[model samples]
Target: MEVVQVLHMNGGEGDFSYASNSLLQWKVISMTKPIVEEAINNLYCSSFPTSLTVADLGCSSGPNALMAVSELIKAVEIIRQKLKKKPIEYQVLLNDLPGNDFNTIFKSLPNFLKNLRREIGGDVGPCLFTGVPASFYGRLFPKKSVHFVHSSYSLHWLSKVPEGLEENKRNIYMTDNSPTSVVKAYYNQFQQDFSLFLKCRAQELVDGGCMILTLLGRRSQNPASKECSYIWELLGLALNDLVDQGIIEEEKLESFHIPKYMPSPTEIRIEVAKEGSFVIDSIRVSEVDWKVSNNNEVNKAKSVDESLKGSGYNVAKYMRAVAEPILISHFGEEIMDELFIRYREIIADRMAKETTQFFNVTVSLTKPK
Candidate 1:
């Protein structure tokens, strides 16, 4: 039998799109910037090189990539100013899937450089900006060429959907009420994708190089019951609801699946250890309060109600509007509205009471000596 490829916004193109929205979350960005800066400082200090080569894996097209790279440049400039030494040349690499929207990123580059020029006031050192489109799971650059690698909100995504999610196969993940096949299937896929990611990243980093990864993670090893607890399940249910309502055909709904996985901190540690190329430097966990829109309670409630009523395509418009092009490409326009309504109900009814809506784990790893 032929294998079916499930495409959802997870690791490849979707990672970048999701990141675009995530970057707008000022609270999250503010908390993450310092950690990233500290990691860069540590790498620079340990390496003791005047020039630095940095790469942002899974960097999507838009201000987010520029924002991250700019922050790194600023951090390095501050260090140089304090030392009274000339700023060193910086090579910044922005990487994403081949299907990523580099046009948007490329268009914004000139503006970013202009802003940099103004900020440095003719004192800025050499900087090279390059766009690389490729999967992070494989070699994108020459071996040992990268000095610092930074990835945020990207690692949780799996390279591909787990094998054996077909109707006949037994699930590999666990469930709250029972050891159902559904949970088992998810667990198996998560393990495979995560392992491959570690192996690939290990080959890319040079000995002593540092990698700082920040992504959504789970605190508990136990399985969750509600579909909203997992992004993929939430999306699946929404699509199912659309099919049931005759908004979309069953064929289209059947083709949808989340391509990523969210793992616990312990699982991450275990996977990294298996690679045998990196040592854990530090692990920091923080709450990530992600809100779809403005935090105004009245407005939020109103939107929620509108979404559930399937009024004015508000539900589908909200999700599809924010969704990456890759997903839109797969699902097309037919299911958009239904998906929105289903998603709204899931969020309002299931996720509203939860305080720990989302959590981020920042793991700093250094290539082994």
Candidate 2:
């Protein structure tokens, strides 16, 4: 199956489900709270409607899934109070690929709604939720429908692996030692994908509407920068270790490609300029620990094999939740637990000497009135 058919966060509320392992994404979104609020403020100043339309694109199923929406809702509630008038009724749309765990989200909907109503107070009007499963690179909403749009940690996923990536043998993503063709392929793919994203949102957003997007990005123009590509490079080493042990086929390693890319600020600016839909308000670049955390709790009663600790372990769980489906599709389901076990070990070892950090890019855009 194509990755589009298989790529999704681990479904259900199991131990490894995204709901169980999304602290990192939550942190990223939290860090962007002020940014999201800024967009909502702009929305209030511009549109100021009693009924509003909002969307969280790439709203994967998990604890972090509601992070963006909840924050936006709170902003909406606060705005209504500040205006000292009747509260607005909201239409909240959560969008992701069809393979996403919408079932889990819908099942948990009752509690989510209850919490919103309780926290936002009785003065607030109704808030309706809908799950929209489709590619954000294309039209997902009617033209000029959404008042404000938000997406966090989601734009990094390319619609598909770049063409000719089979030649990027021994690596699934761009690397320091990668050929020039490999570098160009990844960058070009990101350009096309992000351009289409802006174009679609341009159509969906009304005049003077706003968008706040936070995505993984490179601090350097070179896609081969250590901070940009080292995660997958280390992952490549782990896969080769599995091959060395004769546990997996080497051919399998060469054929697999990750359907993700982290674009640079330069690339993003070029795409936004070329697309010419939304004016670039500002781009705020931030840093996050690649390990997600420096500490993971340990339970004395748990066996060593049953428990893992520290940044590596937490980051491993986060990656596994979001990327496990692709791995299972490529390598089969049986190796998943073992594969993550190996990945965790590698991450832990690397953590001892270096700070594992990644740069994030948050761009604010406004559709012209």
Candidate 3:
């Protein structure tokens, strides 16, 4: 599948929209707030530009879209207040693939600005927001134009599905049973994509500029480890179930593969060294419970089984919001409801057997002067 054309989160304000199901992403942003704040402060102190340029690559639609940008503006404001510096202008760039729901973000822009102005009062400076619809795998900005960059819950997605996965049939991603060739193919693809990402960002960011990236990752170097690949494995099983029911062709299931890779910290460090553009300031690996976003529903449940069911449904919904578009692109929309229903059941059963969590790797990098 052409990931660039199909790899967008579920859009709109519906029950399954990314806007509604992105609490986990919000948790990621919150977890890395200190890293983002420190990076922005250091960048600002290095050379406080009267007009600053900031870009949030992969700033998918929803409340989380302007979230990091808002925090950044506040960080700059705090520093300015401390130094009694002159108010500054901000050129905020929200970038994502063309397939993303930029309209949702655009519509909410006015209210976002209004709230910011209200909070900052008369000290508020001009904050210009522009939506840049393009892939971040390549150049999206002019040279040395961006001062600060942030991306959350993105970058794990490869530019496209890796080639030579024909042997990876009956599975959508690297699984324990995947052949060594399939695992190697996925890793090779991630290396190439990540290197390109760093090179392009290096060109766009000015010297001393910094970036914070938070994405799905695994603790182990093993690409097929359960921590990173189990979610996709469950998805593959759901697809296979449909195939067994004859609702979807087995050939179609065999051909489909998610264009994503959850790299290990070792892999990330290696890729950064190979790219030779930016130096890693800090990197951390953290785990978030699978029910992180569904805690409220689970808490309200009257029984253990009900809580488990809620957690599973919550997870299934969020996963659907993120993965449904690509699935629909390849398998068609007719199978979505059924697929997720079975998926939720499978997830509930799995959670009953073991605790599940998503591993996240957040790294901060700086362009050396």
Number of the top candidate by TM-score?
3
Relative to the true structure, candidate 1 has a C-alpha RMSD (angstroms) of: 4.8
Clashes of each: 11, 0, 0
Error of 3 at 19 (Å): 0.6
Per residue, candidate 1 scores C-alpha lDDT tens digits across 1-369 of 111122222222342243333433335556788877887777766756777888988776545657778887787777767767766889999987776667777777888889987886647778898998777766788877888888876666567655554552111122244235555766777777767766776776777788888876667675453322454455556666766778667765555445555667787788888767788888887775434323233344556554333322332333443453545666575555456666766755544454324677788888875
Candidate 3: worst 10 consecutive residues by lDDT?
116-125
lDDT of each: 0.63, 0.83, 0.92
The full ranking of all candidates by TM-score, starting with the best, is 3, 2, 1
lDDT of 3 by residue, 205-313 (tens): 9998888998899998798999899988998999999999999999999999988899888998999998899999999999999988695767899999999999999
Residue 367 displacement in candidate 3 (angstroms): 0.4
TM-score, candidate 1, is 0.81
Q: Residue 66 error for model 1, in Å?
A: 1.8
Model 3, C-alpha of 10: deviation from truth (Å): 0.7
* Candidate 1 displacement at residue 138 in angstroms: 1.0
Q: What does the lDDT read for residue 352 in candidate 3?
A: 87
Q: What local lDDT score does residue 162 receive in model 3, on the 0 to 100 scale?
A: 95
Candidate 1 whole-model C-alpha lDDT, 0 to 1:
0.63
* lDDT by residue for model 2 (141-206), tens: 999989989999889999988887767877877887788898888878888899899989999988
